[model samples]
Target: MRRVHKALWWASWCWPGCDNQAMLVEKNVPLQSFNSFGILAKALSMLRVRSDADVDALLSNPSLKAVPKFVLGGGSNIVLTGDVKALVLKVEIMGKQLVGETAKAWIVEAGAGENWHELVRWTLESGYPGLENLALIPGTVGATPVQNIGAYGVELQDRFDSLDAIDLVSGQHFTLSAAQCAFGYRDSVFKHQSIDGEGGKPGFGLAGRALITRVRFSLPKNFKPILGYADIEKKMAQSGWNAAAGAPSAMQIFEWICEIRQAKLPDPKVIGNAGSFFKNPTVSLEQCADIIQREPKIVHYPLVDGTVKLAAGWLIDACGWKGKSIGKAGVYERQALVLVNRGDRANPVTGGEVMTLAKAIQTSVYERFGIMLEPEPVVV
Candidate 1:
């Protein structure tokens, strides 16, 4: 096995025609800068992947390929528990363009490294408007489908066109349509691991095996704004922008969503946090009814499929965890669904502390409501 040192390789140092020479691998790199949670950690080895060529080059090195690898994007949705042992591939691909347009839709593609919120703003500015509902969500474009991120009544799957990725194990590039991603409520094939037996079901799981290079969104033409989300409704009423006058434009909704999120959620730059710490647990109508009988003031919404989605923040607040702290990790005062790093840049929250507080909240919520709150961020 070849050992990586803390150094940079020059272009002339690499072999001609082989990508390995171009891929620079750094060692013992500090990671507090990469993750949004501001947790201090280190990567034993890390490589910045700017393109598919970089991936190919890294794989061409037998020593690098022999070890486990971790694909990191914006680091907004992960809690680093400790130093990463795997080779870290930090995706930094960059591009944004209108790939094509049909009678019904416009397809816009972005590199995996592009900021999701910026992408939304770009789409609206570029005259493609469907992604406005999802504005201000943290993390990179590539991580969106992995989490099936949604906000203001719109989910990534609703805007997804397709994505191109490379199989880490085979080093082969492949494309997957939205259906192949199998997106669900804060879940996707990327969240699941490959099954050993049964050859795995089609469109099942691909976690840890695929590195998404680019993502394409299908923004419909002649767009209609998706409104009526409680926050959006509140904003509309406050601004006196009635949907009845005419469906508010995508730009208006985007601005409102941005304002709403800023008011509610803690800025990661100012207060380190990974958006929502828990997924809003979904339950059967019967379960919701039973909980309602006991709690009476429970917050919930009915889904199209006859299920109810409970407000995880409401559950957490009911458990009296808002603004509560365990060492350097604490729940945001404004939103119980979020967990913040109470420490400063020099001494940030540790991953262990975050998980401990998370587990405690999970236990309390489960004990009271019989529903275990599932965490939204990936615990690494």
Candidate 2:
């Protein structure tokens, strides 16, 4: 095996190409520090794969086949409850490309393991404008499609073109177009389906599914930049962005998004968190209208499918869960959507505190607005 670089560690595993006598920490060890949410969990056997060959090598391990296996990105959008019984594979490779760029537009490919917001700033610094509004989004490039991650009125599918993914089953590579990804509001095929086949073998039915190593974006050229979000448009108008529209670079939008995010969400570094805890629940337009008739100030976003996306944060705040504390866990005071770890307590914290608050928010929102808030991270 070639020398591989990985910042995280996982549990030990015996594999074909690896020397059984000498074990590399990067290849297999418990990883409690890599995740932002700070769950101390040991991967039963882990492998941080920098290359496709390393991924294949793990697949070839018969010991890993019968036990569980999981593909992990930056571990930003996950809450690990216990030591993962599965072999957790953390992706750590990085790269970027100006695949195509016009005077006013550009397309780029970002490595799956690259920080999402850092990539956005990179695009902005290089004068590529579209990604600024998405700055500071948590997680890696690979997981973007998993949630079709969106915020402040923009989504990954909006600028997405195509990408390649290895089929964990066939051990072959395939490309997926934006449409083929079956992206929806905060959803994609990967979210509903698992790489491990429940109906078949270990990696069966995993077509365009595996570890996503690279993501290609088809960003706009000569397009009207969106002052799309109401609050953002208001801020931009105040900043004289309307006076010199094209002059407001991606960095401007990046700063705006960062300010908005900082104002709401707690810094994950200071307080362990996985960004937004719940996804905005989508209800039928009529249902939203009914809620609005009762409250008269219900907020919603009109979707193309004619559904109304209700703000999950507003619902949680209205239910009085904001700043509610339980042991070492508490909801963020400023943003009802974020759950924070209180850091100072000796309380035996199970990552389940995130789930408990999520349930409260979910139940509260459902009772108040008839909308069930779906959590963004997989709780296990």
Candidate 3:
């Protein structure tokens, strides 16, 4: 173990102005259990942040503040390349409640560390029903905003209200509205790095600089289920429910989504994998039309904006990658979008293997379809 500096040691003890109530800075911590991929790695220094005060306490120490920090949420959307040398702040903040209600919607707030799926379930059970389409999505609340996570027919930006975050560099607590988040398809300001514009204007990006503390959602009071996805439609047909006659309740939609996801996606606990390795690539109508002419069976959805979203899983399966393995990494047989660790706990897949397979898939897809698949997971 590395020796703790005097200032760091003192700050840990003096935080919150109480004895034995210090911020614990763990060293050489094993991270296999922390990450959903089950990749074996070690954090040279780690801190489990349970509250905003913990961040304040960590930032208060100059020695700790100067070191590079990595904010880890549920670890569902990251690929660790190797042992992390930076100080890892594992967010564990927890809480969820209805903050306010309006004629238009009900405002709900959740701690960043809260399980995203659990939060979705809570909202529905508590009578707030907007998050049903996103049921069974992995990762934490903090991570959801970062990726602008979406499923079925709804995206996070659809329900996002605002979020609280602490600036790691400035030690400033701040809040951002949905517009400020700049949510895109599986992307947000948090995924980008700061950049300077043409005229020395500041560009928007919060990656590595902001530590999300809490997130607020605005679930519409007049609940309307977002349907039309093939999976949901199939479920509705199976249950003999017609949208024209009467729509299913929010709970029903949630249950259907859960079943759909479970059938398609492997549970991270049972199988070492991340959900949806690639974003469904979007292309212009002309490009989609050209591809359609070449390959009539290509799975695609037409977006309202005159663009087409191509199903990445279908593309991978088309390329004959399904049920195939490259070392310890393999494309899932059921859903080619997911890459799994074929190795057991004793000899798990390395991040290198995952990336190698991902690169090969990207190359193959790009070469065949002229569409380069973008990986969803952040490589750390």
Candidate 4:
């Protein structure tokens, strides 16, 4: 392959008479450090995309056009089972700017590869306050919309403006509004597989098809703190704040959230983990009442739609999974929702062990509560 630049270049697999423009590519890349779970794996071939030009060039390359590709973001929400055979596109695109402001909202955009927590901090420091409730979230800005990431009482869709993405198959550029993206509880259209010939058109899912390039958030100009979560309310009480008192500043809420998250969740850097291992299972009120009759102390919350959301952590804890280890994988002691790698770098937890533990937890929870817990991380 002809060299383009020192930093980025085309892969040796380029077809004859291919364009000379260099695209960054690496072979047999180690990926233990890439995923939050610290699972050992390798990518047969990897490409680093720094701009739209890179993606365009990649899609146009004859040799790579037919090869299967995986769009990777922050690597915080995936589990690597083994070596990746598909070409891995590691998005390193980076930029953030205030796009515009309207009468009701401030529009700010960030590249898909930007660190999510850092983006939250940047917005707060730059005088944007609406994202404070999501502070300290791990992963990339691109992954946020895919997961419909939320914490405390604020979700990404609640502050979403729109997003720009490139279709991997058709190489078409498009923008999707919040409604078009179809955000759900810790889920989105991007997480599901599209059905064929459904509804006399294409199906609803976008998983593995679209590459998010940039995301814009509509932070409201009239921001009010979201303090309905129990932890935040406890903090408010401890700080001597009452209903008649003024609302807490965004910075204060941000600090409190950071403190609360740190105390409950294990840092991926220190202890290999994927944050919450499972999504809290939701059930109908009648089903919840039945479960509650058998287990009166079961923790649950009533949703706006009359569904009852049960704490997966509580069920796991009640099953004696807390602080329990299976091989090198274990459930976190402080928070049962998080599965962790008990081994260090020399002998980290294997993806198989992690999945095994996860299945066991699911079986127990289902048997006890009649609720099947779904894993949050993508299993590759």
For model 2, residues 184-265, the per-residue Cα lDDT tens digits are 8777877655445566435312323467888988777654556678878777777777765565655677787888788778
lDDT of 1 by residue, 183-259 (tens): 99999989988864556555458999999999999999989888868888999999997746888999999999999
Model 3 over residues 1-380: C-alpha lDDT tens digits?
Answer: 87865323334356656456766788788888888888888888898999998899888888898999999999998888899999999999999999998889999999999999999999999999999999999999999999999998899999999999999999999999999999999989998877665676676898899999999999999977788788889999998888586878999999999999999889999889878999999999999999999999999999999999999999999999999999999999999999998888888989999999999999999999999999999898
Q: For candidate 2, what's the RMSD? A: 4.7
The superposed Cα distance between candidate 1 and the true structure at residue 282, in angstroms, equals 0.9
- How does each model score on lDDT? 0.91, 0.74, 0.91, 0.90
Ranking by lDDT: 1, 3, 4, 2
Estimate the TM-score of every prediction: 0.95, 0.86, 0.95, 0.93
**Model 4 reaches what TM-score against the true structure?**
0.93
lDDT of 4 at 205: 88
Please give the lDDT score at residue 303 for candidate 4. Answer: 95
* Per-model tally of clashing residue pairs: 0, 4, 0, 2
- How does model 2 fare in lDDT? 0.74
Q: How far is candidate 4 from the true structure (C-alpha RMSD, Å)?
A: 3.2
Q: What's the lDDT of the predicted structure labeled candidate 4? A: 0.90
Error at 300, model 3, angstroms? 1.0
